[model samples]
Target: MADRSGNNKKKVNQGATLKKVFERLGKYRIFLIFSILLATVSVALTLYIPKLTGHAVDFIVSRGNVDFPGVLRVMVQIGICTLVTALAQWLMNVCNNKMTYQIVRDIRNEAFHKIEILPLKYIDGHAYGEVVSRVIADVDQFSDGLLMGFTQLFTGVATILGTFCFMLSVNVKITVVVVLITPLSFFVANFIAKRTFSMFKIQSETRGEQTGLIDEMIGNQKVVQVFGRGEDVTERFDEINERLNRASLRATFFSSITNPSTRFINSLVYTGVGITGAFAVVRGSLTVGQLSSFLSYANQYTKPFNEISGVVTEFQNAIACAQRVFELIEEEPQIPEPEQAVVLKDIDGNVKIEDVSFSYVPEQKLIEDFNLDVKPGQKIAIVGPTGCGKTTLINLLMRFYDVTGGQIKVENIDIREVTRKSLRAGYGMVLQDTWLKTGTIRENITMGRPDATEEEIIEAAKASHIHSYISRLPKGYDTWITEDGGGLSQGQKQLLCIARVMLCRPPMLILDEATSSIDTRTELKIQQAFAKLMEGRTTFIVAHRLSTIREADVILVMKDGKVIEQGNHESLLEQGGFYRHLYESQFAH
Candidate 1:
């Protein structure tokens, strides 16, 4: 009963996936209809050519008594059929190519759009390489399968039907022979397809795992080498690669069995038709030319069974791949903003976190009943040890993940009641992990405000103390960088990110260890720039280095997901509690 239930569920899922694929295809229904019509025309002409050949054969009744004119006229008809079939087949292929690629394009676009809106929790929980595989590798595999189905499956089925009709017109016995043996081919293909689907699905998953491992290792090669983990990484990779190899081999073995197995069955059908047709001719019930036509029809009728078997095998893999792509496209996105969500404008940045509770996992308590309130334009610094919810607080402020409990209000309005875009747009953030796209330095700086004037761009760069470095580059502001900001030091990358936020000068600022990478001298200069940037604007500075937040209006010390103490730097030092212990530990004599 359990096995039966599982099978039923699998069938339902497959049916739903097929429905999605067809719905995408239905958008190009006109092209699909045209392709089918052309396939029919092509197969009809192709099937007719065999009969014309048989007629040309019959016209040679005797060697010298042959009606040459009759044979020539039949040959002319055969030529016309061949030419028309080729033309129709060509046009059908063109239509199929256009429709198949368009559907793939739509699926890719939806998947990418879904990724963009996916909640931070979902992205954080999944490997980057696995998601990338769905978009790139799995989509490409589906494309190949769809193309094969369009190019071969349509015409193959049409030829089978046309040949059966043509054969029935010539002789009934041969048609019966071909029809009787065709099911064996289907039985073999169906049995293999059932097994191969699960195996191919396994193959795709393992391939994703392998891709994720490679991406993880390559992205952090420096860390891996520093930690002397090359051998361990290679061992892990080999294990995954072996699993992928095993799964691929099993799937290919089953799928490969389909084509030849069906061909063997088809060969038997052909032999049966030839043997039965010969006896009919001996019985004076059929002419040689008619028997010849029936034999050609028999071969044609069984040929599609072989071709369709291969198509089924490939289509199974495609379905598995499409399932992954669709899964990504259907992934739950970020919680939707309220229908009539307020759009924040000219924000005064008073913020209150009221009785907030949250956790990455539901069962584990991370932040519980957390609360804070700040006046507008207060430079509040958050200092904490690692994983004590400093970053989680930042995430909540950015609405990357919604709190599980309680409310966070900005300017006396619930943050959830405002559009996320508007809420996020009011703040400038520079994290320790700097990101720069592959573009000119000017482009990276002006990303938040693209219409910033050249003078403004230069000013921001100068303020962040990066203008001198940029001026030294060969192309200055126009110098192109790689995606990972290649050829740039960690300090330089951080400065570029700082310049980015400095240019925006948003109503609020979030600096999550923003100056952690730069030397102390550069840090002091950037801090001065940040001081100017923070003037009359609310700022939340998260830092492990206690020295930097000394000038902040308020300092909130946190530990174990709760604030332990809050005061100005001098008062917090006077308390001589956990806050003083942390400060003393860092700046101890």
Candidate 2:
């Protein structure tokens, strides 16, 4: 009754995501064709063996005499069939594996590439672990599971069809009894599968959340320890883990019951075939060999019912995982690059932001009607409170997010006119939080300009004031930088990032507290290095330290994403506006 209720609204074989999976497999249709052909030959040969065995029994029993030579001939035929069937089945498995791994490879490649082009908003909105699970864990499960499930599904149904055709030829009356009962297996499988689809989906999500929690805790373990929230973190992890466990258990339990229940129904059909066959024999409607053949065919015909039930139940989880993966791969990527983009070459560095308005969310306006202008090689400093859209301006300029209104032009050409890669390449950036992959110091520093000569790399390092420190390490420039720039001080990491920007020597610079990690003494050296790097380039500096931007050509004091004060240092001080107050607050003695 429970299984019957479960099937009422059942919609298994999730069409949208499943369609994509087969589309990928469609590329290997030749391999699919061979596998099917082999499966056909295998199932055909195996089913013929029962017929041969039944004939052998009749050859001896009807004559009431030993017919060793005749029976041996039948046995020899069965042996030949079994051997050829085994070979064909082995070839089918090989084809299935070849098809499965290639499809998985393409999926994983597309998924990884999808991450590269995905909008930053998607990355920011979801937990890092959840995304990782979709790309890595969920993809792996979908591949391995569907590999097994799909092959079983194809061959299982084929075997059932072949067996039914053969059994019908043997005795239609008993075959009808077997055919009548098989739908019960389908009903139970469909019901349980539909019931567990959402549960498995929940399990995938819970697993992702738990994975994300682990990543967040481990990635920021230092902060967690500093704040002494170890117990709190554990409590949160345990709660997520508990939910995952429940989801997994329910999904597995519900799906698992389908196989045994379906098998029990098949067994009852097996009993019915035997009872009916015995009556036919007593009434001289069937021979003893025919009764033997009928029962053997009954098992062969009904076995696939049990296998198909199991496949459907198990494939539900795979379907759920695949859908999650498809959800990510199908997300709208960063708006497409312009079709006929203008080349950004020999940029003169003039920039104009006219009436640019932007908002991350529609209801919450971050920047409204903002405007700015800077001449070639000028330094522009932007200072404001934390949530006042300081970083949002950078995001707009880099085209990470497009502006909702107005235009930003470089050299009098609107930035949208050029390709994103070329536009970004025009500017060098060093942010407050530095990023370093696991590689040597030289590799991380030269990431922006991979073709830099050794001498050029050394010069850039010297410019960032990190050359002397690199010389002291055992491997010098080759010393490895591990996860989170392991074994290096924050200042060292910042210097490496600065060196990266220095090597590129772009036409423009954007420094967001790029020197915050440096000590007072190193700060002086870095500021000097920065002066060289900034020479003859348009520079935008987001600084909290008023002294860092005192010499700027123009300083803009921003509030709530709008500039409230603008002028050179002394001029702004003379005006005594927000800039003056902000500077005074920090410098007051």
Candidate 3:
């Protein structure tokens, strides 16, 4: 029963591997046809070489003379054939390389697009390094295999069949002797390929994990140093490095055995063929020319077998890589855009959430039976402890993830009824983790609406209280920023984010701990900008600082995914409830 099960699994894996390879190649059918034709030409050229040598031998023995003219004619014919085959081979290589590059480009683009549209849950579940590894290492393997292994596999098969046909025509008895050893050689080659493939798969997976670990270590280098865990980190990394070394060694060792073993088998076949041909000659069944031709054919046949073994090994590695790449491409995202969805238009930003419930995992509910209503132009504040689902609320509002239950409406329309792009276009956001690409300050601020005029950009920056600072720089608004805006201070980065949001000028605005990273003085300046920006826009503020929310028209204090207290700031204080307790505790310090 166990053996049956293992056989079934092996068959399934083989089918899947083949399916993936064909699917990848389907886009390059034209190139594949050209490749096959070139391979056929190359094989024909190789087989003709042995026949030409046979003719030369026959001419020398039968005429008892060199037959220079006949020999020269054959040489010229072979040369022409060789030239045509070489040109065809070059064309085949060019097409194959083109196909490989095009396919890799498409796969990388698709992967990046999928990453951009994937739901937050999907991203949260994966490591950044692993995701990056899929884009780089795995895709590169597919490219290498497509360009190198695929061409070799087809060409080797053609050469093998062509050589076999020529050998059989020369002498069937010697052909039979050579064919007898093929099965054993095949079995040994397959066994080595299987072992090598398993090791390569392990190597790829471990390499991805190690990449993830290294990315995490670099991202949190400060944490490592602060906690004095550098030595511990080093030890952990060493363990991963050791595993990688072992996997690489195992893979290389198995792969190294394939070529030598194949060559040895070919050598044995050559010896057997030589002995059998000599016996046939002595038995009066073959002439000296026939014996010489048989030896040449035998040698030619072994060349293909040797080439085929190497090609097969490479194909196995490529299949392993294809398996990983297909796994990623086949994954269905947690959230997908609806077909033919309606696009929202002219939204006034009156937002309402009714009995909304959500959870990253099904069992651990983060928000349940939560409700809220914000009239147009109203400022709403949400207060909660960490993990109380404040950001989750914003995520649902932005449709990053749909609500697990209940309904969220924007401008009197169910958010799900509108297209995702339209739904997001109605709102502007300033997140705690502000990101800035490498570009001029003007470019970053005008990213969302590039067509915005220079005057409009400056206006938005002024509204966010960042224009003065930018104007003072040597390059002014054109000052270049490094990736993640490294030259800017944290407060400055946040201000730039605000400036960007202001340029968008959406009807609804969300500030998620926007001032949490700034000092008191900078926070005051930001708060002033926030006051001006919030005017006439429906705004949602999420903050731990009570002072930030004290003036809100409506305040909702939440705990354990429930809205435990709701009222205006003064009314909530008078009630001396959860909101009042939070205010007292937070401000009393």
Using TM-score as the measure, which candidate wins?
1
| Clash count in backbone of candidate 1 | 0
Taking all chains together, the TM-score of candidate 1 against the true structure is 0.99
- Summarize candidate 1's per-residue lDDT along 206-309 as a digit string, tens digits: 99888889899988999999999999999999999999999999999989989899889989998998899899999999889998888888888888888888
Q: What's each prediction's TM-score?
A: 0.99, 0.95, 0.94
- CA-only RMSD, every prediction: 1.0, 2.8, 2.2
* Sliding window of 10 residues with minimal summed lDDT for model 3: 56-65
Clashing pairs in 2: none
Query: What does the lDDT read for residue 580 in candidate 1?
Result: 92
lDDT of each residue in 1-589, candidate 3, tens digit only: 9988866885587579778667766898998888888888887886787688777666675555678888888888878888988897888788778777877888788788777877777788888998888888978876776677656777778877887898888888889998998666788788887667767778888888898999999877879999999999999999999999998898878877888898898899889988998889899898777778778777777776666677666666666766776667667765655676778887777999999999888989889988888898899999988888888888999988889999999887888887888888888899999889888888899888999998899988887778889989999999999756767888899889988998998888999999877888878877887887788889999988889888899888888888998989999999988888888897785
Rank by lDDT, highest first. Answer: 1, 2, 3
Superior candidate under lDDT, 2 versus 3:
2
Which candidate ranks first by lDDT, i.e. highest? 1
Model 2: per-residue lDDT, tens digit, 107-208? 888888999999989999999998999988898878777778757777787888898998888788988988897788788878787788889889988999
Angstrom error of the Cα, residue 26, model 3: value is: 2.3
Candidate 2, residue 225: CA error in Å?
1.3
